[model samples]
Target: MSETTSFGDWLRPALPLLLLRLLIDEPGHGYGLVEKLRAAGISARGTTVYPHLSKLQDAGYITSHWQTPETGPA
Candidate 1:
């Protein structure tokens, strides 16, 4: 548990850099971003990841849009 806490402590300092890298290939939703972190060997859970997403959004390194379908019968 201590190791996990320590890693989380250390990793928060580099959040901006990692977030930049994650968005480099493509913009992603919050959950997709977490998977990208894992692919890079960073274990990012929702508690850790969402805050970083909030920070990155505040910093404007990326942007997000909700998907909409145009095939409605209306």
Candidate 2:
């Protein structure tokens, strides 16, 4: 649909900002971040999010590491 496409376009520029906010949020990670954006109606994918993440990292706004999810919460 054009609306979804346009909305996605409109949202594309904001991915980095949103991603930063999500990182400040609890339990943030690769798939969870994507899912949250999708849930918020962004139609986010790696092509979009990964670049912004890389940019944010390059700018020293965030970092990444391997998170091993536990079977249960601590």
Best by TM-score: 2
Q: Judging by lDDT against the true structure, name the best candidate.
A: 2
- Off by more than 4 A, model 1: 1-5, 69-74
Per-residue accuracy of model 2 over 1-74 as CA lDDT, tens digit each: 35345666767787788998888867476677899988987788977788888889899999777656686542
As for model 2, its CA RMSD to the true structure in angstroms is 4.8
For residue 51, model 1's alpha carbon misses the true position, in angstroms, by 1.7
User: What TM-scores do the predictions have?
Assistant: 0.68, 0.71
CA lDDT, every model vs. true structure: 0.77, 0.80
lDDT of 1 by residue, 44-65 (tens): 7878778877777788866767
Error of 1 at 32 (Å): 1.3
Clashes of each: 0, 0
